[model samples]
Target: MQSRRSRTSISISQQRMLSHSMTGLSLEQQKMLYYVGVDVGTGSARACIIDSMGNILSLAERPIQRQQLKPNFITQSSQEIWQSVCHCVKSVVRDSGVPSEKIHGIGFDATCSLVVVEEKSNKEVAVGPDFSNTDQNIILWMDHRAIEETAEINATGDKCLKYVGGQMSVEMEIPKIKWLKGHLPDNKFAECKFFDLADYLTFKASGKETRSFCSTACKQGLLPVGVEGSTEGWSRDFFHQIGLDELVEDDYRRIGGSVKNDNKGKNFLSAGEFIGAIDESVAEELGLSNHCVVGSGVIDAYAGWVGTVAARTDVSLPALAKSDREKVGIDRATGRLAAVAGTSTCHIAMSRDPVFVDGVWGPYRDVMANKFWCAEGGQSCTGALLAHVLTTHPAYTELSQLADAASVSKFDYLNSRLESLAHQNKARSVVHLAKHLFFYGDYHGNRSPIADSSMRAAIIGQSMDNSIDDLALMYLGACEFIAQQTRQIVEKMTVSGHNLSTIFMSGGQCRNGLLMRLLADCTGLPIVIPRYIDAAVVFGSALLGAVASESFDKSGAKSAISASRKSSIAGDLSQHNPKNSLAKFGGIGGDDLPSPYTAPSATASTSQIATVGFPFPAPDDVQEEQFDEDEESGSELNFKAQSKWKKDMEDRMKGRSSDNGDTMWNVMYTMTGSGKVVQPCAESHPDRVLLNTKYKIFLDMADTQRKYRQMVDAVE
Candidate 1:
């Protein structure tokens, strides 16, 4: 069979002629630039088309195939995912009625899974346990089959481990690569070329093998050249210690080549930086214009951060000034946390200077934005945990039937049941319904503050109840457990100097009001919901495309390219002082290194480095005048204004109903894509005492589990 590239080939002169014809169009037509964003999540591939002002015009989705060969092992097909992406893009462009030539740029974001392909033919290589199914070339991000390899990497105590919180996670690419190398045949391993899923998507679009800094620095063990006093991008000594020294041969060709010595001329791009035009054959196959450029890609969660962090909010929060709400400059981003909650929850915080937090996955420099360091903490499972709890209950079938009969979602039905229970028991709030129950929600494992993957869930105060009321209580307990864990994570981050005061959330979970309320009340911080919750990640990718297109000058697109180039250049380590580095746990001297099994405690004397080049703007800076006059006119509308608007709208729409009627707030969200802000209950609220008590119990549950583990080990 002939390849798709050969079948859809177009001559170079035809492409040039097509490009020249666009200049003859009317001025208004030339100004109407559009962008496409494709997101490859675990279960599906989604695409969206957005105009210059960030309004999503059309969206589409298609489910991809996944295989579970064994427990804790998940695999996928790269070809099938690519097909889904193409179909979704085609559908969105057709539905939106946008001309192909008017689409100026495209961007991609995907799970940080690993992909293996033949170096010469670019054919898929088998990664399954049987090693015979070549279509299953992708190793999912959630696969825990590399547990032993993770332990081995952590045991080496290499200096590179410090950047990943002094431990390696099985979820990262290195451990997964190690597992493949040890299990696959030597011939198959030698012929393999590895790419992160996001990079793979880029390569599929542009036919360029350029890797992204976001993928290399965060998941793979590549030390960014200028940050952390490193002269070369890849640490050869660390690779040698990890027994994967073959990867260092040929300038690390198996992976993306090293930054300083890339023989293949492959560039490592930052998020939204340009990566050449899309391949002509690929553009034809996907029903796009050949003139469209492809932007560098990012992990899905990082895309969520990009989508939600720079939202134009009405309130002046602790993180950003009123003028800076539309821009995510380094200084303004420090006080905000981007919690991209879905099947799992990833908490991303940025800082002007590197702030090392124990058990967090970063302090990785120049990954998300230029001159900024990102620290990532996460929960291994949140939505999955809730699903497990709800599905395993005896009343689940009855609950589903009732929800269908009422034309409501199961979660909404459960929320109503909990409210009724609260009323019947005369409880202060729904939180008080689970007063006697306590849950430890590490069913998958702890991803932060402990960094232990061997931990399991523990529940107390069970009474063998099998009724719907009992199910509601259990669900409430699980939600509370998620919130309590968030509190612990925030405490860890704040103690290490993050200073987070508000959470900007995006994903499917943001639609769940009960979870949002619990998150705010539990953490005592306000939550900022994005305008588009389920589509935020894909919208973020579209933002990346917009930045690459450079149609809007306010996005700082040119500066981003310059900063990435400067960071990638060799002999540029003057800004990073060796004494201030956290490579040795705050640069402590001697053999006093902490154990590899436990997270190192942050010391009071931890180094604080000054921000280089990008200084914090002054309060009275004149640059604030550069904003559009219309934006500045009504920019002072705070949370109080939003609340009043909501109330007035509710009163106006009273007793009116529609097919889409769920709540007045949701109706408001649909009509105007204006997001909602959820604030914590007052300090004197009736449930405060019970919540505090439950939080204490939540803290103790982890310690109790550790003691149980110790007892079991002692007996053996």
Candidate 2:
């Protein structure tokens, strides 16, 4: 095909002339008005036009191309991504009819991937010849080109690796760069520039090669500075052992020199200062902003988390009154858990102190919206798991044909058939049976707790029936699996000091009512599905711009409000009435204490509730002696209460402790990179089974033999 530019240049030129005509206006009319936020995802790129109010005026999208080289080697052209970004910006601005001079700021968020650029004398060169001159730099985020390098790095047992979930994923740039060095040494020598995709976007827009701490902290193994006792940004001994010592350049030039904390007060580089006012020369070519600010960007998932997590709501009803801002699901509290469920699901929770969970990624300080430490746990295929569950069934082909004939989706058809069957079975206790046909979902390998990528999926029970009745059960099972996995994460986190009260869910999957209901029933916690699941990333980027402008600090609001407003904001989406909307799993009940995150099944014989956090007895749960309020008035309430409680408990336990010989103790373990595992003390519980899920134990025959011996002795 002929080049698009070679053919579309004339119209682009005319559009450029029209854009510049506004600069001729008077000085008073010259306003530092709007800002643009660009978000690039796996399949496409999007640009948003927003004024100072955080309203999204107009947004545009342009699809980018991806090529799978080898089985695991995924590649993309830096040129293609840059062009798509520019195209989107121009489209949104043109479609909005907003004056170019009015756009004062710009921000970007993209997938965190490696970009490889070769040096010829000094200028960066393309990786290959096909579209070499125009587009041969970026390595896509999903690309697993460095699996071997990642394994090798992990083998080093580097202290720095602990910051990123004990294992260094091949998806990061360091491993990819290492792969390039060993596999393509000639290219490695010729290469002068390497960047995370987000950094690359900023470089393309503002002519700067700076890196953000968000990228380095999460992906590039940057040993955090100011933590006291850390020598360099990375561990020098660790890097030298990994055979890529050169990555730690003296001036930090190859990746970045300066770190721009967007949360701190840092203005985005003005349009003119970087890309030269998006002038006629460029405007006639790409048809973009002349006065718009082009901003430094962030990873895509981080952007999504930023947009929707913190919002001040005015819902005055008592139903939402139980919503504690200090709770995990509400915006008023810090350290709340927000799970973004899409093709995959990212579970994010922040903390005041860095608490590292064994298999979960991060202790990433200041990475997510800043101020607090972030811990990210996720399921690799959340929505994708649901898709796989529906599509691979034997009845899928017939269902597809029937749905096509009816001009509706297979899911819609399946739901209709399911509802009809449920109506017919209304007299029977079929819904009870439906709940038992549970799905133990590990379909896409476990992303957290188990981090076992090679583990295959299993279905506990499946009938040969291909009717819609079977579909409803199968669908319910899928939702249950999602909730179950989340429960496991909550269990582990609670043990380590996270007090989760609610789950804030966002993403397209939150639209699935059956899934949402199952989540409620399974987790037993109130699920807050944000009004705007799709446009969260844009809101997040706009918030970043607002923070940079000192808006949050000035208002004492803690969260920044966007300057430009979108057509319809994300927070305004309403829950669809199920009478007309799709059939869901479960729903909102009366304002009681929202079900616990892991509640026991009502039908199950065991009355035990799956309480999180080390399964310890709460102080209040224990019997305490009563004290006269007037007599204890001189003493503090807490101290006096504790004193009386301790005396009463001691007297009660005098003979019980000696007779039972059962003790409840807490054991805390912290894994260090030096291969020294510290267990302060090991506690034995007689009343319950104490299994430390934090450590890896092999189930091989020899290990089984050892465990059997311990079990037998414990029982004795």
State TM-scores per candidate: 0.79, 0.66
- What TM-score number comes out for model 2? 0.66
lDDT of all predictions, in order shown? 0.72, 0.51
Backbone clash count for every predicted candidate, in the order shown: 0, 23
Candidate 1 clashing pairs, residues 3+ apart or interchain: none
**Residue 232 CA displacement from its true place in model 2, Å:** 3.5
Residue 90 in model 2: lDDT? 84
Question: Please, what are the lDDT tens digits per residue for candidate 1 over residues 1-716?
Answer: 32222211222212222332365655433334578999998899999987643567889999998899899889999999999999999999999877887786798999999999999999999997758998899999999999999999999987778888888889999999888888997567888899999999999998879888889888997777776566667888878888888788898888887775332233676677666667767988789866576878999988888777644344444544542444322344566788998889999987778888899988887676555678899999998999999999999999999999999988889999999998998987898878889988799988987899988898898888899899988899999999989989999989988878788888878767898899988888888787677888898787777555542111221221122222111111122222111111111111111222111211111242221221111112112112222332242323343334323322332332211111111111111123457778876776665777788998888988888899999999
Worst 10 residues of 2 by lDDT: 664-673
Error of 1 at 398 (Å): 0.5
TM-score of 1: 0.79
Q: What's the lDDT of the predicted structure labeled candidate 1?
A: 0.72
lDDT per residue (tens digit) for residues 1-716 in model 2: 32222111112112222232355654322322355677777778888765433445677778888776556666777777778888888887887666754554466777777777653332444432223433555667666667778889889988777777787766677887777676553444435667777766766664445466567777787754543245445566776798876665664556564233232322212111111122223433335443333334567776665554443222222323354422321133344577777677877776667787876777776454333467777777778887887787776677778889989766667666666666787723223445335355665455676665544455657878886567656865666567667767766677777666556666666555556654554444556554344655654554444332221112211111122211211111111111100001011111112212111221122222221111111112211223333432332223333334323322322221110000000000000000000111113321011112111111132234446657888999
